[model samples]
Target: MWSGPRNLSTAMMYAFAARGDCAVWDEPFYAAYLKATGIDHPMRQEIMTAHDADPDRVAAACRGPAPDGQAIFYQKHMTLHMIDGFDRGFMRDCTNVFLIRHPARVVASYAQKREGPTLADIGFVQQAELFDQVADWLGRAPAVIDSHDIRTNPRDALESLCHTLQLPFTERMLSWPAGPKPFDGIWASHWYNAVHASTGFGAPEGPLPELAADYRRLVDQAMPYYERILRESGRNPNSPA
Candidate 1:
């Protein structure tokens, strides 16, 4: 799974982890991204110390067999973390799914966590680039799921997604026990409080939260990229059940 921050990604990871056969990995490239870029993210030092900071090693692991001999390996990836120096070849070996939310929603939610996000910080451009890369490699568009659709009707949305991925839909993907899992990255303390407090997807989001002028401009910069991918993402939360 590939997504930006605050995009229901953690919940989706928990849902997949709830399935006994799947082994989930949370943001494997994050430490490497931070190390390479030297960006001052919250928990930057601790995250680099706790997680492997070598992109090559991380990429190798991603291409390696599922840990502990599990039948499926579900890796939750952040599009922003795939910085320029990182090798993306490993993605060729796995199924790629893009998880997206409206730019207004992403910008609003992200601002509440970390102040003053830019277009790169929120990952709209990187996501579209990655999507196109995968699509080019496969000769077609890859699977995509909107966060709104997942929140609005998780069952129908995930069922459709599972079908696209050729996996059976299980009620296990709908919810999980509240709190952190062993797989969460060390940065979870700074980023995952809301997801940790939940057992499932939250109530469908209310109207897109109002944004201040500068943030609204950021959303505008991100909208074209969001809409480009949304055109390929078949699910619509507002569509009739």
Candidate 2:
């Protein structure tokens, strides 16, 4: 899934990985790519301090046993991480799932995260820029699901996603046992909150107390672009943003 920082990306990763037979690759190639590309990202130090994803090993990991026609494989990725010197085909060839939240909520969550900088401080504009870039690359046809909507009606939402990915619908996909699963991104505990730890769908969370108003404002701005993209692609959400 393509996601931005502080969104429910990891939790969604957990949700996907929760399936007993899925092979989850949590930010599998990210750190090595970050080091390879040499971007001055705020999370650079943390990434360096965190897991060291060896690039060569990353290639092997990304090329894990071809689908095997059994479990759904999950790969946690960020749209922002596509920098120079990385294999762009990594995301394009995959079943491309996009997870996004209101920029306002992202900012607030960044603050609570105690990460180097708040989304307001750096991430809001930067992350959105990367988001636009990924969208452009994916064209208007990219598969996207609002994190809010997923949390609100996960069964319906993820069912649609499975349809998009051409995977069979299974009730087990609705909810699975909670708790940490394999390849939980290093960021799992810090940002996932209690909601991420659970298996069931939830009342769309993320708009924080401090950013509720701003969240609505940004959501309004994003709606037109989102609507246009969905319209052009002819894939409307059961509940449009």
Per-model root-mean-square deviation over C-alphas: 1.9, 4.8
lDDT (10s digit) by residue, model 1, range 23-105:
99999999999999999899999999999999999999999699989988999999999998899999999999999888888
- Candidate 2 lDDT over 25-142, as tens digits, reads 7776557756866755546667766866576666555655535553667787665554445655545446666666655566556656553352333233434444455668867556
The global C-alpha lDDT for each of the candidates, from Candidate 1 onward, is 0.89, 0.60
Structural similarity to truth (TM-score) of each candidate: 0.96, 0.70
Looking at candidate 2, what is the lDDT of residue 239? 41
Q: Pick the candidate with the highest lDDT.
A: 1
Candidate 2 residues lying further than 4 Å off, grouped into runs, are 33-50, 56-60, 66-70, 115-140, 193-196, 206-209, 212-241
- After superposition of all CA atoms, the RMSD between model 1 and the true structure is 1.9
